[model samples]
Target: MSTALVLTHSVTAAEPSADGAPFGLAWGPITKVPRPFKAEHEANLTALFYPHGWDPANGPATAEVILVICRDEGLQQVVWVGLPMSGEALARTRRAIHAEGVRRYGEPGVGGTADSEVWPGGRALLASREAADGNRELVMTAVGPGYAACSETHHAETGHPAGTHMADLIGTGSP
Candidate 1:
């Protein structure tokens, strides 16, 4: 994602900058999203998606894109799931995208697992990961004040294992 894309898609000039919120959705309130999105409630978390399709980003087409919001705490993360791929193509795409993330956010303060790269920031995080089935994804999570609490709540209610949610990386000193 280019800096131009980030600037053009951002919420409003008056709102606090959504440096970590992809597509320019800021980190507060469901109503503030500019695009019409459908919300799916799961435990205390809400997964919001644009049913009518969103404006395309510059790279490979996304099969799915979700913005996760913790109950009442507002937007928490943006997940962009690229279409499934296999073999060398998958590796190449993942590498290219991961490199782009590094260029945009600098070296990650933490995270260099075999299948993923994570960059932690003061208020959010940027990460790229390749799933076992070869699906690649980019995750941008808000890690500010209430994130830890939100992570705890989601884990408790959903029974998701630790580190299952990208936002769980917060407070792990891994960004």
Candidate 2:
């Protein structure tokens, strides 16, 4: 696999939720700070992707909402991408994502396949893998609006591993 450019930023505009959650709504633009992925980072990505199987919530034990935007070939492919806090959160976000899938692709199940007609401005596509392996990487690629890609890496040993690394490359921004 090619080494991807990892970027991160602290979202300061939004306040914590009413319940005092660690997550806040990210507005404006995410700062692009390029950094190499370390072993710890990989472990974290595993947890996020497969939280149910991970023994203890190693991180904050809080649900963080992330919006992943991707673009390719000068076209905007996806938007408002919300990652669930845990495996249970997956069920909740799944429905909403399915709805969006239908709206964009005219179909609900877009798993493990390349979808060229999913988004309005999206072109050239690839879907996430079906196998739930921690080491397995889930990614989608498109080329049109601009070169963009979203990658999710699971843990290799444990069945339940929070995604340690989730990265997106959209337009000129990196996160």
lDDT of 1 by residue, 38-111 (tens): 55666767665642245422233444455566786787655554545666865665566556556655676655
lDDT of 1 at 121: 51
lDDT of 2 by residue, 51-118 (tens): 21121111332112222222111111111222223355444434444454454445533322342123
Off by over 4 Å in 2: 1-84, 108-110, 113-175
Candidate topping TM-score:
1
Name the TM-score of candidate 2: 0.27
**Candidate 1: worst-modelled 10 consecutive residues by lDDT:** 1-10
Top-scoring candidate (lDDT): 1
TM-score of each: 0.59, 0.27
Give the clashing pairs for model 1. Answer: 120-175
